[model samples]
Structures are given as C-alpha cells and as structure tokens.
Target: MENKTNNYSYLRFAQEGKECIYDLFDAFLKKTIIEDRAIDFSKSMTVGDDGSIEFVTLEKDGAEVAFSELVGGDPSYKSVFELYLRRKACKAKDQLTARLALACAHLHWLWSLGMDCKTSCGMYGEAISVEEHWMDSLEDYNRESGLWHVNLSEAGVKQDLTLVFAIFHRFVTWPTRPQFKSVNQVKTALVEFVFKSKKNSGAPVRNGLLHLCDPDKYINWYSFESKTMFVTFHSEYLRGYKVSDYSELLAQDSLYYTRKYPKGMKLDPYQANRTEEKICYIFDRMEDNMPA
Candidate 1:
C-alpha cells in the first residue's frame, strides 16, 4: 500500500510537469504563427467573410467549458477569462467578449485612419497586456493572490488602457469579487483605484472603455457632442434605453462554444474608416435638412 501510494504521487507529479511543458510549447507555437503571418504594413488589412476584423488567432483544438462551470461562474472572473480566451482562441460569445471584439475592431480601424491621436492611443490601450508578454501574465495569474499582489510588477499607465489592464488583472487574480455587480460598477471602481485624479480621465477614452466592456449598456461615441447629436437627432432610439451598469444583462448573452464556432471576438483594421464614412453621410444629410 505504501509503495502504491508513492507510485500514484509520482505519476501525478509527472503529469503536471508534462502539462507545464505542453503549455510552454503551445506558447512558442502561437508566437511563431503570429510572426509568420505578420501584417505587411505596405498592404491594407482586409475583413474576413464572417464580418469580423482580421486578427491573428491560434488555430488549435478549441476547448469548451460550460458557462455555469466557467471560472466557477463568477461573473467578474468569467469576463476576464472570456476576453483572454476570445483573443487567444478567437472565441467570443458573451456580451462582454463580443463588445471587446467590436471595440478592438473599431479602435483598430481608427488606428488605420489616423483619425486623430486618440485613435492610436485607444488601439494600443486595447492591445497591451500587464506583463512582459500576455502569455506571461496568464501563466503568472495565481488565484491565491489578491489584486494588490497580482503580477503587475511591470504595469504602467497605458493611456486609457491603464484602466482596462487594471480591470483584467483585478478580475483574474483577485480571490473574491468586489460587492459591485455591473460592468460599469467594476469600471468605476477600477478608475478610482487606478487613476490618481479625475484630470487623468478623458471622457471619450474612459467612456469608450466602458462601451468595450458592455456595448448594449454603453455607447462608444468618441465625443460628448456625438452622443448629444445621437440623442437629439435620434431620441426615439434611446427613449426606453436605460443603461444599467450591472451584470444582470450578461445572463441574456448568447453563449455557446464549439470547435467550429469558438468565442466570437474579432479585431479588424479598416472598419473605422467605413464607419466614419457612414457617419459623414448622416451628417451631410442632417446639415442639409435640420436647422443649426
């Protein structure tokens, strides 16, 4: 019996070590794939047939976890992992993941347009990770450690992205969720904790971050004037639209993961220019018809 117990322990150790090795190899392959398919700056980025912005994704055996069993079904934890996996595996089905993909796609598009400095800032904000490398952060995440002690020793102010990174780190490493229940609540709390003063907060940048977290509940208009225009010219669209800053809506999100259709996140580069053209068309018509 003693010898059998020793053998079992040895086997378990060996298996864990083997898994660690596999994870390292997987990371190497993913990096190689991304490098091999590096976007040629001389050529324009294109959209995929699925209507998502073309971004690199690891084409590996997709893994599925029931929504109920995901990160123990903790809404906050689930959201962080969802974004991470969606980016890593191109899987995004839930509201948060979907919005993240959309926001990143739009931000990337804006980057391509050189619309303004904010476009470039927002793009880097979404792309950055908290560690020397993103996979390092994933590997360093220890649930036993709390937010203050997570693997953010290398963290920096990534413009508005500082808030996004802080949120991701908090959700993934924090042992427990804060009392907040909504995505904005999480954002607001993180903003207070991460930014030293309100002066550092830019409305479009911060609000855009909020929209990325929950598109149904928040709009990603780049300016307050744009939001006002949408409200003034399209009041009926927002008549009953009470933006709730909570996670209750996450329950209604369409979520299913399979090998064929993993999470549904996308990041495209040219989408911003197209969206801008449509907005300009609307403005042109409004200018001709509406009183200033």
Candidate 2:
C-alpha cells in the first residue's frame, strides 16, 4: 500500500489447482452431502452460449433458468457454478444456511484483502461504504403535517464487497459454525464463497470487475497481432477502469484471488506470475474452444 510498488498481496488467497473451476465442480459433485430435494445436481449441466448455466429448477412448475438471467454477462465458470450452487441451496433448508454463512466468509475475504493492502487507498475504500443500500428516510412515509415522497435508492457500484456483506449481515447474521450445526457444511460454503468472490475484472486493470470468478469464460480480451499485449475487462461497468487506474482499485486488492496451495498459502511474486500465466493460457485456449 505505502510502497506503491503493486505488491499484489491479494494473490495470497486466489483460486488455484484442485481449486480451479473444473476442480471445484468435481469436488461439489463428490461432496455436497445434503439431500437434493429439488434438483439432482448429479445430472450434467451445460453452459449456455453466453456462458450462462443451463439449469432447471424443480420448484412448482419445475421451470428452467439460465445463469445469464441472474449473472450479468459472459459469466465465468466460477460465477456460473456459484450461482448454480446457490440455487440448489435454495432447495433445502440446511444448504441455504450454509450459503449464507459462506457469504459472510466472502465478506471477510474482501475486508481482509483490503486491510492487507495497508495503503491509504485501501484504507479509504475499506472505510467508505461504496454502495450503501438503504431506504431514503423521506421516502419512508407521509405525515399529516406534510407529504412524504418515497424513493428507494438503487444499488449503485460499491468500492468493496465488504460493504455489501455488512448490510446483508444485518438481516441474516454472519454465518457461524454453531448456527450451521456442521463444520463440513461451513467449510464447503467457504470454498465456494472464496472461489467466486475474487476480483476477476481487475485483470489488465481494476474497476467494476469485482466479484468475478474465472475471466477466461466471463471476460473478453484482445490479442495482439501487431505490437503489445492488451487485456480488457469486458463488463460495461469494469471497462471504465483503465490500466493503472489506482483510485478505482483502491478496494480491489488483486486482479483475481488465485491462491498457491500446499505452500503456506502466501501471496507472492511467483504466484502472481502463475496467475498471469493461467489467464494467458485460458485466453490462448479460447482460440480453440471458442465458438465458430
């Protein structure tokens, strides 16, 4: 933070091998002891053209919904899966609790990473509630003495996910082990939460790309046939943050939270480089896997 050297400490807790999208999916299939009263996730799920998940709901009419409907655009496998898991959680009572707990863990991640930055910018983003979603007091009601104009504030961009979690916790207290009644459930939820909560949109830079999972599927990047390499966050909100746009990234500590496992879980230069390589590889692979 103070060094202004782009320490990139956020990489310390990123998603890596065995924790990647594919790996996480495998684990979810193997684990997840909860009884799926709604949809049996054991059934193979496919990705939509827009990268949304083509999943079916077992509710009342058993209607179907795609990941794109809920998740913005060009959804990543990570975000796609998280959304799917959350939907499944809705089917059962226990999983719903676990998902909420995992949300709290995700909030902790946002808070912890910003603090790790230890920079003035980090402090600023952490302190300020970027998107404060609350009722406009005047919009509440009307009085005999005066007329009340009610206006519900929309959810604008927030600097950090911590702020979102703060408000959310107010209604559904932070997820706790005791409350969940199972450590395994909390642990699983934490994995999904951590995996999906990283800042995927910050790759070539920083901005609204926060809360992304894997950019390979979610993001769009330009390949250079003439000169230098260029990466871009394709989201309408994130594209605004240009390269080296420090202010916008005051809260976003890492391009993506891809971790180095079985090695003390430290965020270092090697891991940073590894993360870059993975992204590069994904884009490269896109050439072959991309639609015709």
Candidate 3:
C-alpha cells in the first residue's frame, strides 16, 4: 500500500508539475520588464529535427556564453527567479524539488526574455569518446547448479536525471517566439515526458549522478568505488572546457560526496549531488560579478 501511495503521489506530482511550470512561465511573462538592449537572443537558435534545443553561445563584450548562462545571468528575471526558488526550497527543506523547480524557473526566464529562443525534440550531437568496459567473458554456472546466469547491464536506460533536468530547463525557459510552442503546451509536455521517462525506467530506482554522452548514452562514473568516470561533454565554442570538466571537479572534492551510497554501490539518487548545486552556484556567482 505504501508503494501504491508513492506511485500515486508521483503521478499526481507529474500532472500538477505541468501546471506548476505553466503558472511559473505565465507569471514570469507578466512580471518581467524587457530591457531595451536585450539581444534577441533567440535569433539563429534552432530546436533541431530532434527534440533537443541547439544551444549556441553568443558573444557579448568579447566573451562567449551559451544561451543557458546568458538567460541565467540576466539580472532582471533569471537571477531573481533563481534566488526565490533557492530560498523557497531551503525554507521547505526540499532541495531536490527546489532544484527541479529552479530548473523550470530558468526555462520560464528564458522564454520571457525573447521569442527568438526556441527548443527542439531530439539530440544535439554525438558525445566525446572514452574507454568503456565491456563484458568480455561471462561464467556459465547453470550447468553446475551452483549459481544463476549473468547478463550485461541493459543499454538505453538513462541513469542520469541531470541531462533530462537540464534539457527540460532549457525547454521551459525558451523565449516566447513565433516558432515556439505555447507555454502551456511546453510545460505539459515537460511534465509528461519526465513522468514517461521515469515510468519507462521500470522502477523508481535512483542511480548516482549521470551525465549524457547524448540522450541515449549516459555515463555514471562518480561512485564511492569507482570514484570517477571520465567523460567528454559537447560544447559549441570551447573545445577544452566541456561538461565533463565540471564532473571531474566534483569527483575530486570529498565534500561533494552524498554519503548516501552503501560501502560498495554508487550514491543514491535521492541524495543531493553537489554538481547540480555547483552549476546553480556558478550561475549565481556570475550574476553577482556582473556590474550593477
């Protein structure tokens, strides 16, 4: 019965989650004051043939920054929304939910910023290559009647929620424009997609911090046992500093470990990973450094 209740709660959460996201977007649109100098940041952006948004960085004052950071760095909408969500989540003692909420807020903030911003429905591109372990051999013990059979871990299971979260964040925050979907539709789709992704994963199992090579291939390298997973993240502008750079930093810092994993297994998903928090913190810091 407890399991049933949790299932139902999540179902309801998904449904209402869409509404919550839509409401936030609506509020942002109504409340934000557009800056005259605000670049039509949505220009040149495409949602792609697939569902993924093609994020490209723009040059401002000789610095290149992605749309995510640009919208996030905006003083008027993005910063305020992030600050509010941080406080609200802290007050409720639900940081995970809070982070999710902030991600949604970021989407709304982006959407409100301009119409040129758009979203797509598929993957951006390929992932950086790395050495991956393959099961070269498997012992057959069924004939001996001493042990059961073994199987390679299933492929296509998305263990990382961060990429999903980040993608949804970008979708929701997409600026209102001629090509974009209605805010309500975007919100509903995000909630529905998240629920579907979770449901398809078979069970409510949480894997440790997951980063995507693409939406289909995810790498889970941060573990108490493995301690680190080497990966290369795609960047439009910079070749050296990729998403994996951030992951490497988190792995080195003992303070970032969740301490929720057993002695052997990876950390629990429910426990807060510092990587996501660090991303948000960096955004906040950037906002602070910008001239007022």
Candidate 4:
C-alpha cells in the first residue's frame, strides 16, 4: 500500500511538471516570433479619401488596400504576448482551478483588446471562479481553500446547484440606474453595470429599477408644470402609467388645468392657503387607506 501511494504521487508530479514545461515553451516561442516581426509591422501608410491605400494593394487573392487596413501590427502582437504572461502569472496550484480557468478566459479577451487581466480594486469584490460548483452543478466544493474538488455526494451537489441558480437569477434581475445622456446609451450602461455588479456580489439580488424599460426601446420625454412648480415625469411610464398608449400632448397646453396657487401659500389662522389644505387632505386620505 505504501509503495502504491508513492507511485501514484510520483505519477501526478510528473504529469504536472510536463504540463508546466509545455506551457512555458509555448509562451517562449510566441514571444520570440513577435519580437522578430517587430519592425515590418510598424510601417504606416497613407490612405485616400476614397478608402484606398496609395501604394499598397491588399489581396484576398487579389484586392486593394483600404483605409481600415492601416493599423500597425507590432503593438497588437506585443499586447497579446503580454496578456499570456499576465494569465500565467495569475495561475496557482492552491487557487481554485475553475477560477484560474476563468481568469485565463478573461485574459484572452484582454489580449484581443490589448489590455491586461487584473483583479478588482474595491471592497467586497471577489475574483470570478470557474470551479465545478460555480461552473458545473455536479460537484461539491469548498471555496475556502480556493481549489475545486470533484465527486461530491448527491445532497451536497444539489445544495450547491441551488445556490448557483439563485446567484445567477439575482445577477440577471439587478437594477441599473440611468447615467447616460440618451436612453439607449443608458440601457447599454445598465446592462454592463448589472453584469459587473452581479459578479462582484456573490449572491444575485433584483435590481431596484429593473422594470423601467427594455434597453433597446426609445423613450419620449414628458413634463408637468404648474404656475409655481415644475414636476417633470420624463415619461408617463416613469410616473407609474400602465395603459401603454398615449397621444402627444404639448407641454404648454398640459399646464392649462393647473391652478395658479400663490407663491407664498401658507396655512395659519392669519393666512388662508388652498394648496396646503389640499395637500393635507391627500395625506389624511393616504393614512386612512393604510392596512393595520
């Protein structure tokens, strides 16, 4: 039994060492190719207004160079090589293998964009893990050690699966406030915000403002104005309107029904105020409608 255990350990160590060596060699070869092709990649050529390159003819079999074909390649290759380096540096035997895989995938995207893969820089943010509990539903795993272990009991696996679904649902439903100038821009921003926020927050929760509108839809502006006060609803939907249909109404005409309350409307035995009296009446009505 002792000899068998020692043989198994030796085999595992050999396999891991071989994988590490192959990865290192692959990284080294890519770096060499990029360095060798550095100079010819930096040449810039002028492009004409007709989207044509003056001296260069791009051939997909045979074609002319266009304005869009004028990018330098050296920086692009260098960026990709650096990305590989960053990914390799982040991987560790003690860390969750699934998380490391996710980090590697993120590095691929960063490499394509010439960006570096990096950890989040704020409180309560955790790096994404790709282990079976987070990646697959068939395994039980502990995150405390940062490594994913497989072959979990049926009950343990079920609990982990439930936790995963709950997290994903909460992430999808989180609200994103509008912070862009146009409604469409705001929608895209919200989608990105929700994705990042959900990844940061371990458990998914509904976003407070997720029901506002479809991100792809256009919104019209609406405003309400009285003589002394202007209350802009931006749109009827924002004001809790559910009818789904409304005709165009001019802002100036919409203010016609608003009564011209005095600017200094007050309530006292010495002063008479209709607006204050109406407001008080509305509050009393609201209080009366409250459930015990």
lDDT of each residue in 71-137, candidate 3, tens digit only: 3333355344435434423222354333334334333333222111222111110011111111011
Candidate 3 wrong stretches, greater than 4 Å:
1-79, 86-209, 214-255, 261-292
Listing every candidate in turn, what is its Cα RMSD in Å to the true structure after a full C-alpha superposition?
Answer: 22.1, 21.9, 22.6, 26.0
Better of 2 and 3 by TM-score: 3
**What order do you get sorting by TM-score, best first?**
1, 3, 2, 4
| lDDT, candidate 2, at 90 | 26
lDDT of 1 by residue, 206-281 (tens): 4333333333333335343454344346443333344342243333222210011123422221112222233344
Superior candidate under TM-score, 1 versus 2: 1
- For each candidate, the alpha-carbon lDDT, in order, equals 0.31, 0.28, 0.28, 0.24
- lDDT score, candidate 3, position 207: 23
Q: After superposition, how far is residue 236 of candidate 4 from its true place, in Å?
A: 17
Q: Give Cα distance to truth, residue 181, candidate 3, Å.
A: 30
Of 2 and 4, the candidate ahead on TM-score is 2
- Residues 104-143 of candidate 2 have per-residue lDDT tens digits of 2323322322121211112222222222111111121111
Model 2's alpha-carbon lDDT is 0.28
Q: Model 4: clashing residue pairs?
A: 58-65, 96-146, 98-130, 98-131, 99-129, 99-130, 170-204, 174-207, 175-207
Preferred candidate (TM-score higher): 1 or 4:
1
